[model samples]
Target: MSGSLTAIALDAVLEEHGLTLQQLAALCAVDHDWVSRHIEEGLLTPSQHGGEWRFSSATLLRVRRIANIERQFEALPELAALVADMQEEIDDLRRRLRRAGLE
Candidate 1:
């Protein structure tokens, strides 16, 4: 261990519009089928254009969170999605608090 560990920064391409289903699966370390199942279950949303599903950063982030929740607790995908929803709300509230100079 070191006195202070340096943070390792990762830079992503950050698709402005969105990422392809394959790209999002790679980013979330999940199989494409798993992503499709979640999407079908209404856990993840992807924009449909030209017969392809495109995922935005927000969607990608939620995918990672839901995957983590599912793995950590062996929970169902719907349960994981519920937890992710609460987390997103908390993050939004935190941002609002920061903007109001209360956090």
Candidate 2:
């Protein structure tokens, strides 16, 4: 989110498939240092594989979602809460629609 579309792509690849930090940077065509900084900043969290960082597809997707929201809102905390509420509302609506056989 703080970065660019490249960051979103990197996040997507990581989310879709488990990847190491190095692998993720490579996929994004960026430096490992950049990725490390982002991770340290709490923008990313990679799983550990034998003390090595690994990423899951879900995490990447989450990162992408976070980034997208941040880009739109410019403030992560507010956007994150808004997104959560929106998702809950959507889920509730879907449930009601299903009960009505209109889903």
Which candidate gets the maximum lDDT versus the true structure? 1
| lDDT comparing candidate 2 with the true structure | 0.65
Which digits, one per residue and each the tens of the lDDT, describe model 2 over residues 68-101? 5656777654455457457657877999999999
lDDT of 1 at 19: 85
For candidate 2, the TM-score is 0.45
lDDT of 1 by residue, 29-95 (tens): 9999999999889898898868999887788889999999999999999999999999999999999
lDDT of each: 0.86, 0.65
Query: What TM-score number comes out for model 1?
Result: 0.84
How high is the lDDT of residue 8 in model 2? 80
How far out, in Å, is residue 76 in model 2? 2.7
Clash pairs for candidate 1: none
Question: For model 2, which pairs clash?
Answer: 15-57, 16-57
